[model samples]
Target chain A: MAQSSYGTENNNFGPGVAYSQLDAALLVYQEAGGRVSATEPTLDLSIHGADGRVLTGGLVADAVSGATPNGAVPSTVSQNFVTPLKARGSTASVTGASGGSTIIHLPPTPGQLATAALGRQYTVAPNTLPVDKGFRDHRGAITLGWSQPLGAISDVGFGGGFSRETDYQAISANAHIAQNLNSANTTVSLAVNSEFDSSSPFGGIPTPLTVMNAQWKTQASRNKSQLGFVLGVTQILSRRWLTQLNYSFDRQSGYQNDPYRVISVVDPSSGQPTSTLYESRPDNRQSQSVFWDNKLDLDPFVTDLALRYYKDSWGISSKTAELSERINFGTAFYLEPNARWYQQSAANFFHYYLVGGQPNPAFASSDTRLGSFTALTYGAKLGFALNGRSEVYVKGEYYQQTGNGHPADAIGQLRQQNLFAGTKAAMVFLGYSWDFH
Target chain B: MRRPLLIILMAGASISIAGCTAIGPKPWEKDLMARHEMLVDAYPLLIAADEHIYFSKEASSGGRGFAGGGCGCN
Candidate 1:
């Protein structure tokens, strides 16, 4: 990675308001349209038996370039946050499953699915986060799931999976029960999920809210646990219309901070960042979300609409809306167009920099993700089926993110610059699947 | 908040229980409902990959089901 010497030109770095040449250079660089891009290629394969049993697998490779978030504030004078970076990686997985009335001999109608799967993935995401940009991580996981019928009108299912990564490990389990009433015209479901995680960033952890120590001493790993529950209902409104509503609540405790992130220390009045310190976060978080999805079948055209509302304990809240339409060209080919809009509020303790004079808050971070932002995504998919047994599809999407750079408290030259100008990226996918007896 | 969530769940349950079969498709007219595309998650793998991408880039997660693999991304 080639880093320009933008910081070396400034020497009179001190407290209070001071001249900040770095900010001017940064605004110019951003105005010149410099950004990052990422690519992901994936291949999916599936085989099916006449008895409702299925086996599936896939491989995904990713190539990412341009600057990701570095926790440090963007140079007020030059291009710092948009670092020159690159990374490439891949993941592979396999799974076997059974569904519909595979177990019950009677009632050929669809029941549910039972599945078991094992997967492994390895990735080398280099030049991303500051901590050992050459970070290499791999993970392995296995899951088993089963759903059984309760008489003729209800069903119950449970599943669990354990995954271990080079530095992070997680174990999760879930159970759900559904009841079909009014002659199966309506279905109600309640489910619960729990996860236990152990994470240890590479190069060891650092003391929170402290200046970067050159020694980079090692610290013990941390643990976290999460529990969530969901309630959902689906209704067959008409012959061509269906709708679903779901509400979910989640609580997570223990280590909730990213070990690699840091907070920037800046001049109290000028808002010029002088140095960086490790970031810290609260140990617990709770959140809840509500989602609604609707689908309409209009002969050769199918349309889907979804909306979601979410809020968390960290004072972060978000809303998401998505729409997609599928145009079928007979039974052999189809084209689906999709669009999504998302907006979020910043965390309560989020800040671009910690002022030199003010007392440090209990927790603070400069990570861009913790700031208020809006994102828009547009994509489309085209699929082709070969003789009804095999299918191939291609999908492409473009995403743009914009942050609220100016806050009421922004000081000095900082008020003139768009610290969080914006980020743009695109992704493409090509996949194929086959079903055989 | 808890009371509101409980009320919403109860309302949904009540609606599901009160609905009648007369407004639904007949048993023999269930062909369209049984189609693969009619399933909520028609393309599981693609959806999974899409979820992973969003999870890594955004701060919010889990509108679908849980039990997903964890990552160091966020």
Candidate 2:
């Protein structure tokens, strides 16, 4: 929930604002033609399912005689307060009630799918962990830019902005120079840019004691760094079609390890378990990506497609292809159905469960996020252009990862293929865009 | 090693035959493409913001651009 002192007089203030802020707010909103953005900002306080059937997937081979399985109900977490903010011209306009579901995670651990009692399903109530997930309640990003003609088919731009949530915050500014040329009836353009990101690691497991224990222990810490240059292009194939190409390279050189992840190893001679903590790589890592996008106007509707090929030194490589068609049901509304396919090669140090796998002497922790896998993404978004000036768009996406697990992993139960686990996420964005001269 | 070669080849081939890929309003169409919401505008601010969020949280990229920076997220 966000609360605003400037617009307290009126409950919901859009372009219209209080007498003092009215001019500034409207001025900022008009500057870019205008843009408004806001995410879920949920305040759902319903008690999630914690009726005991939610078993903790610890695989202890022995739960204390009286210990009960507990994975469904997230730790004692509930948003007690919320301070949502509304902004214009990169400044806060209103701060709404903030307290709400921030990090909602669905249940079912990777290990629990097998070797567990099946009868528990009926007894387990639907567990809805309130979004006690991230470091902060609200996240917002704003950017303003300008481009001026430098030549027949060329333009230049300079701009910057800052964004932050609870655990992550970034301040970035960039400069780009572009060029375009006429090829018969076709048009081609290219650009080069530079930007940076300063961030901290609070995205993964929240609890240190729990998430990074046993074979796949991992911890996280704050990371601050600079992300360098990129080059891109755009092509206008014809009046009915358009295409674009962009490439970027980034190098994060700083602390690169989970301060919290840990693992247990057994002594060779003595069959006893000894725990070892894993840390980030001592050397800075590198990442590079290449992307291409095309949009074709099929009269009433538009078909858009994008393909990206990416690779990094961390033993991870991937290719992603996505397509979305925006169907206009007239000037009032549009519906977009999207489908995407992604396949990735595992990171060098990644392992399913590290107990009996090849250990990387160079890096301490395995990058589970980059395990070998193929994932399919499907979703839809409905957008309505309201009053010919404002718009509201809502989207829902369901993603499931299916891939072959490396046969050599010690913990075969956690393989990506056999142990199917997925996440469901939906976003509702209320945006107001107006073109002002 | 292989990636660098591919990138080099892509840049070389793209620039050498760059004329063949050209189309439409030339750089003149930038005014419309530069529009705040046009999918592939000359500006990097908004697209950068969106890509930043996507890279950190999700596993997809929506913008048509090249590689980005290195971080310790993985």
Candidate 3:
């Protein structure tokens, strides 16, 4: 068996602290049907995150104890456990989470558990103090698949998946076909994917917190859809080298906004409407990506490279290149180093804050931002093989984006080094896989 | 592929008639164009509108979702 854990705590000035968390998992596969063989399950097709930061005003000066603690209600903690079993006829599984715990011990209250049921809420305050308002939630997804081989050189597969959280729902349909050639040394595959999403807040805003949930209330009732097609070719040059090329075209034409955000600023010059009273931009994007992958086996060492090119509307076209190499000293032991590069062009209408530039009627948005951006990413993966088919893998990465030739007006004064840290979101993933004979 | 090709040709024709199209990169611009990250997006105006719409309607927010208001308290 294998296990891992990762989490982060952020201290905001106005809102209470926030935390992002993820835990470990173990998966076991058993041979059944026509063949009794070990299997490697594909990663779950659907992923979800619903954590939010809390907003507790500030510290309450406890004169008696000399501890400047916030007189706030305690926070509740919830944990989710997910397990999936991939079988031959189709992929099958089970998943769920556990909640209803009062995690805070201090700042006691009569009804602490009920009060912490929701995430934190922020108030309209400036230079405010901080408090403890972190939260954790859960969601799970499952998919079923079927495949059939045509003769000895080709096979087709079809699958469907569904996922749901407290306030959102998602469903997907997928199909693919793989072909073998060159004496079974070369393989080509093509796939099509489609998904639909419906989301809501489940009446998340309290009457007092109406202002906080205004934009969220609108996004709660929206429709989102995505379609993607991929063509892949894999070639084996001799027994020690494997190379692959994949081209994917993804078309997404739906409500592509966060639904829960709004611009509430006034034009500094005249103090007029800087924000158009819930007037945010919509998006219909088309992204074409080409990726090349190679894996070389060198007995104790393995090397892999992945490169991708992506372009979309909104003026944000990008390229990403990545490299990874692994060295396995012995059984149950391995080390790998990886690095990546990414760059992009800002959205066409991206502006910083509204400057006193001449009025151009074509540009309807007063919110000037989303110019251009470039980023550099780097990270590493450390993995070890477990006894039998069970093993664990852990990975972490960092990304930093700066300006390209043209900085969009939407970026505000963030071109400075001071705000670069906020523009970054680091991720760590841990996973385990095994088979039962 | 055939339908998509027809649409592209039609769009190119309309753009030419309107006299409002960008002068595509010349032969010399291929070096820059061939760079992995360089390409044109046909519909950013629509994308911006979509992003604004989604930002107003979702529970979890991020991506390009930060509106002009630094105070997302709203």
Query: Would you list the C-alpha lDDT of every candidate in the order shown?
Result: 0.63, 0.41, 0.39
Q: Give one digit per residue, the lDDT tens place, for model 1 in A1-437.
A: 11213443332212221321100000001111223344444444443333323333444444433434556655445322211011111112323222110111111112211222121111113222222223334555555555555565376777766766666777778888888876676888899999988887653566788765323233658888999988888888777877888888899898878776777787877867666688988888888887788888887888989888777889988899999999999887999999999898888888887888788999997777777899998999998875444567777787788887777787765676555734566667666655432
Candidate 1: regions farther than 4 A off: A1-66, A77-142, A150-153, B2-6, B20-22, B67-69
Docking level for model 2: acceptable
* Position A25, candidate 1: lDDT: 5
Candidate with the larger DockQ of 2 and 3: 2
Highest TM-score model number:
1
lDDT of 3 at A173: 79
What DockQ results do all the predictions give, each relative to the true complex?
0.31, 0.24, 0.03
The digit string of per-residue lDDT tens for model 3 on A118-182 reads: 22233212211111112112334555555556566366777766765444566777788887654
lDDT of 2 at A87: 15
Candidates sorted on lDDT, descending: 1, 2, 3
RMSD of 2: 16.6
For every model in order, what is the iRMS? 7.6, 7.1, 16.2
